[model samples]
Target: MPEGYEDVCAEQAVVEGGLLGVKVGGEPVVLSRVGGQIYAIGGICTHKPASLEEGTIEGGSVRCPRHGGCFDIRTGEAVRPPATRAVPTYEVKVEGGRVLVGRRAG
Candidate 1:
């Protein structure tokens, strides 16, 4: 496990092509499973005050439900219009069926 990592939820909680919302280190984060991998990113959309948990998963990207802005789940990069800023990405690892989230990636 990496330093600053905290268990967020069970690895099974994040289904394939689905999104799960969780709080890590007192900060809101959204978890998604894509292509058998779990990714963690800031929960709120950069384009507006919207929860990424409510958004839909499109391939390797998450589409914000508020304005349809899309963000890459792997890199936290804004891949669509209405969102010019990238969301914060977090380090995630699965250990013993638990999903652990670490400090934000830079």
Candidate 2:
């Protein structure tokens, strides 16, 4: 984990279509609750700087609002075209109503 950083309580209810964007380590991180687990990924779409928070959250994936690219929220894998590269994904854990994201392990 990065120094001087910790988990932040984003939301209690992670409905099927709920999405939350948070700033961590000076970077925008998108947190989506799917199947009762929190998945953290890069908030910005790889195809553009468009915020994923404004995108659609459905079928356990987030679609880029600017370009129509799709990505799996759990794995951060590109699921559709217009975005060939995959975004960064983080490990998330929930404790005491707080959502904690660990540093990307090497």
Candidate 3:
């Protein structure tokens, strides 16, 4: 719905307590729906080169499958061991049943 936002998938694709991996602007991004809200973050684990889509949704965080690293889906902050770098976060919005992903968040 805004500039730099690209349609990634249907809103239903990101189910509650689940993770959806997609590419936005040629960058890997993971979309998650928690507590009825949608969030976008770098799809790769900061500690390793693992796809976060293969990870599990633990509450409001995404746990890397390769390791036990965790990152806050809302802020992209590393919250667990093995990961000390923060992943990039993106802007997300739902419109017309579609999930749109925008530029990296600050």
Candidate 4:
């Protein structure tokens, strides 16, 4: 999202229990390590731009802190009300302890 903001490391994606949320280009990005795979998605609630990182992460979904809206962390699909819009999801790739997020080039 920012200039020269690269992906995160595979190790950094996970510590011991779950994935890690990181900020890239001033935007919140959720990084999940599920089943040994890394997934990246928008970490902000679409309804009011609430930080999803501070919300609950369960069953591959992240809940909004502002409202009770739920979203699929992998697909960025809003699964509940109060958030009719879907957030942006990015493609994640792990290489040699490094994770890379794919974005549309300008």
Candidate 5:
């Protein structure tokens, strides 16, 4: 575990197709529960200042409502137009019924 990054909340708090915005270690992150798996990505869209939490999630991707672009919730890949940069993806873990999000492990 990284210093200053700790458990945020329980897994059950995030429902399927749900979007949540949280800050861990001063970094804004958007957490999404897709099909039963949780994915964490940088909160804002690359092309605009819109929050990804306002977008819709389908399958493993999330679409930004502001610019109509999409990002792969898994790899953070910018899968659509207007977004050429991939958002950062954090490592997410569920332990003791809590969801812990943090930086990528080495």
Candidate 6:
């Protein structure tokens, strides 16, 4: 694996249309699969420090349960308010059935 990246799980651990929350090096992250593509994003809502896992996935966006705000999973864009700041997105890779997540070094 590359630097700053850690293996999260096997590909099969996250089913389609499902979300998996995990901590990588003490950073909270949420992984989800949509349209056969895996997406990794910050697990906390931008409006407040709350777990994003409480929300529901709707198509390409995940709805914030606390304020009904929505975010685009692909680009981590704040699609609705109560959350104007965009959430952080991570690079995801599937190698030999293992899922890995990491922040690319600039």
Compared with the true structure, all predictions reach lDDT values of: 0.94, 0.78, 0.93, 0.71, 0.85, 0.85
lDDT of 5 by residue, 55-91 (tens): 9997788899898889999899999989888899988
**Against the true structure, candidate 5 has what lDDT?**
0.85
Q: Judging by TM-score, tell me the better candidate of 3 and 4.
A: 3
Question: TM-score of each candidate?
Answer: 0.96, 0.86, 0.96, 0.78, 0.89, 0.92
| Rank by TM-score (best first) | 3, 1, 6, 5, 2, 4
Inter-residue clash pairs, candidate 6: none
Cα error, candidate 2, residue 8 (Å):
1.8
lDDT of 1 by residue, 1-106 (tens): 6679999999989999999999998988999999899999999999988999999999999999999999999999999989999999999989999999999993
Candidate 2, which ten residues in sequence have the lowest lDDT sum?
Answer: 1-10
Write model 4 residue lDDT over 1-106, tens digit each, in one string.
Answer: 3345475555564643254677656667877776666777887788997777777767777777789798876678888888888888876666677777766221
Error of 5 at 104 (Å): 3.8
Q: After superposition, how far is residue 50 of candidate 6 from its true place, in Å?
A: 1.4
Q: Distance from true position, residue 55, model 3, in Å? A: 0.4
On the 0 to 100 scale, the lDDT of residue 10 in model 5 is: 82
| Model 2 residue 76 distance off true place after TM-score fit, in angstroms | 0.5
Clashes (N, CA, C under 3 Å) per candidate: 0, 0, 0, 1, 0, 0
Model 2 lDDT on a 0 to 1 scale: 0.78
lDDT of 2 at 63: 94
lDDT of 3 at 13: 90
CA shift of 101, model 4, Å: 1.5
- What's model 1's lDDT at 78? 97
lDDT of 6 by residue, 1-106 (tens): 8777899988998777778898877888888899999888888998987888778789899788888888899999999888998888889989899899988321
